[model samples]
Target: MKLKSGLMGTIAALVMGLGAAQAEGVKVGMITTLSGGGAGLGVDTRDGFLLALKQAGDAGSTVDLVIEDDQQKPDIAVQIADKMIQSDKVDMLTGIVWSNLAMAVVPSATAQGKFYLSTNAAPSQLAGAGCNARYFSVSYQNDNLHEAAGAYAKGAGIGKVFIMAPNYPAGQDSLAGFKRFYDGALAGEVYTQLGQTDYAAEIAQIRASGAEAVFFFLPGGMGIAFMKQYAASGVGIPLIGPAFSLSQDILPAVGDSALGIKNTSSWSPDLHNAANKAFVAGFQAEYGRLPSLYAAQAYDTANLLLSAMAKSDVADADAFRAALAAADFASVRGKFRFGPNQHPVQDIYVREVVKVDGVLTNAIVGTAMTDRADAYADQCKM
Candidate 1:
């Protein structure tokens, strides 16, 4: 009889514990492009979140990360989000890289009262009035990075710039961002369809336009194609862009052609910080290749989550959210803080492609930009 009563007590305690967690643990849904060309960004994000989880360890977090791939499709993203919110019952959702995808996914998540932390992708709509307390951007606004590129181009005194990007929201935003800081004459601003493989028409137009420099924002496979075409065209003009195009993945593909090209970025493998040094060493040891900004950002996002979890009861979602808002995480980026809008206010750097030990890669040129504030910070009334 005593043994039976003891077993019954244990069962009761277990049920109560679960009930308490149901009332509190901040379950999260993570959505990203886990397959196809943009997979690198997702891989990096996953790794970062994992790193944070490991570091946070078993605090009070019965925290569950429900991972799903959008497959770079809007329909898949929405479907996955619905399953997470309704069936899986997640309290928060994060991670979407493409602006088009984020634009579609964010509204529903916010409307349903789930906090969304954007690991990447900054659509202008979120910044200008669509802002929400349920939403926070751990990355910059869509235009911030491109704006840095524009500022650098202006400072370099480039006479005329031929801007080319896909006719997507991000592409449009990038051109506007560049134009904001660049006071030079526009040779021509051409918009191509998303995933247009052949750049012959655009390249020919660029050459004929007689622009002194070219600015582009093509992440993943698109970037690889365009840069290769630019090199083949004998475009002598300086190739300057944001890291999205000329990143770690595209660097190997672009190879020698990208040598001397410049791109602005938040992180580079060559960064000298202890955390950065350790990360590059470990990533190289694991993947046998250098980590890109996508990888670094994902890594930081995970670390941020882990840090916040450690500071508060993961089961207590509200407390964890409060801790995250007061972000005191040790990011590989050294010190980064979340702005009112949940976007990070961090320094930006300019890196140039240089062959290091016979491998063509981006080398940190200099710090062209520094700790800059995003335009939408004040709007995040949180």
Candidate 2:
């Protein structure tokens, strides 16, 4: 079921009665997974985006936000994108959580002359030959953290490793990203069904593979289920993956099972910086929880849009695009810049899950890669 934001309803009513001058400022439509198994990721993305706008106060009021739940279905996301572009006439689109949904929506949205400021879901296809001037990812490419995980694995001296991910575009990128850095024997490689909860078979395979470590990229509820089952199954192999698989959003559910698991991320709540400190405090004050990587990216995406709006009118496509490309906003990730493909060029850090004051959270343990640019950036002609 597609759910519309109540704030969007109020904004739509206000827009209907206003003349062009009265209905000023940018109209943004957000299509994201807000239901089913992947709700946590989408919820965090939505909350983070809104939290940034909320902090903007008067500046935030310049944006008329419209939100819709994609329900984790590609077809549903496409339908929403079409409505937002053709009917709603939004100036831009943002806030898609899953890569599959992003694949369904981004290209068509940008082709129709609407900018897509991605909050998450930066697939390699969009970052490479499929790049568009109007498409900008506020988050890292899908392979970035996975690549860092691979580097960590290589540096940690794990001779043999078993890897797994969901069978999807992001999953393909995940394993390929790991292989790009890890020059080690793969005891086993598996691609489980996307959104699959049961891991009995996969765990059995990991046990028999003689692997010294296991790396898997399962996000949202999938990760929670897998981690719980893996811990219960008595598999002592170290678990590793990108932050999405072990971020703040899932840590509470995964509980002690996630302790000591090393994950790679571009941002963490414990990150030392002025912008990050405010973001973490504000997120907890607003939502009563620590912000996840998804939240940090979404918060940055909102600020990026706001900053561009301040410099150029969205109606002026060229000027507005240039404003966005400048990336003048302070990112919660600290040092953030767009690569040639409009994907992020930033540091990826290794984090170990730990309890601080009995709350499950990740602590930065080491730097995995610095000033890392995705391998596919050179392939992007734009």
Candidate 3:
């Protein structure tokens, strides 16, 4: 009888331990553009996130990461989100790379009481009136980098600037953001089709506008296309854009044509921080390539998740949300915190593309804004 009682007690203890472990473990569903035009960005983001997870040693033990490629399609993203939420029962939904896809996934995921941590694609609506408690953006608002560019352009004494972006939510945000801080006269504002390759017409317009400088927010293949064409166009006017346009992932494709171009971002590989130095070194060693801003943000997002998991069990939604709000992770950006809207409030820096040992990359040139928060944070009711 005594032996049987001891055996029963041991069995009960084992079952309870298993239950506790299950409660602590989290299931994450990441839907991002993995194929097509923006695949490089998504691939870098995934690789960075996975690198962080591997460093944490909790990827398979404490976290189950399920990644799906949206192919930059909003409808497909929505379908994947629905599947993740209803079928896979993911504790979190993240990694939508495009603003339109984020708009389709984030709100719905948050509405269902699931946490959505954005690594990129922080649309204005989500930062403002549509903000939700369950949603947090590890990346800057879509307009933040452009606003920094505007600030830099204004400070550089640029009198007339030509600005252009893709005709999308983020693109509109970019132009509006640039206009907000730029005191310079507008030479021209053009909205090209998203994923546009040939910029011959836009380049001609920029040349004819008598602009002192060109500011653009084209990302992925569009930016690569524009930079290559602009270089060949023989336009002597200086070109400035957000870091997305001149990211490390795309800089090699743009080659020396991107040299001397300045862009604004929150994170750079050259940032003088212990965390950043380690990340850059590790990323280079692991991937044999320089990490882009997208990769940095995604890496930060994964670390943020691991930090929150250490603080609270995934089954406890409120506790998990509180833990995430604490922002208790060592960020690659060094000084990092969350705004009232749960978006990042951090410094934005101006980085100039330069060739380092025959490889194209960005080097920090100046600080554009210190501890900047998004303009829409005040509009968030939460």
- List candidate 3 segments past 4 Å from native: 1-14, 17-23
Backbone clashes per model, in order?
6, 0, 0
lDDT of 2 at 268: 85
lDDT against the true structure, each candidate:
0.79, 0.91, 0.91
TM-score-superior candidate, 2 or 3? 3
Tens-digit lDDT string for candidate 2 (100-159): 999999999989999999999989999999999999998989999999999999999999
- TM-score per candidate: 0.89, 0.94, 0.94
Candidate with top lDDT is 2
**Candidate 3 structure lDDT:** 0.91
Model 1 quality (TM-score): 0.89
Pairs that collide in candidate 1 are 25-315, 48-299, 48-302, 49-302, 137-342, 137-343
- Candidate 1 lDDT, tens digit per residue, 193-309? 877778989888888988998898888878988888888888677778998888887888777888888899877788778878777776777667777777777667666666666
* Candidate 3 lDDT by residue in tens digits, 1-382: 9569657856876878745644456889999888987999999989889889888874436778899999999999999999989988799988888998898889889999899999899999999999999999999999999999999999999999999999989999999899889988999999999888899999999989999999999899888898899989998999999999999878988888788989999999899999899899999999999999999999999999999988888777888899999999999999999999999999999999988989999999999999999999999997
Between prediction 1 and prediction 2, the one with superior lDDT is: 2
| Rank by TM-score (best first) | 3, 2, 1
Local error of candidate 1 at residue 275 (angstroms): 2.1
Query: What lDDT is obtained when candidate 1 is compared to the true structure?
Result: 0.79
Model 3: which ten-residue window has the lowest total lDDT? 17-26
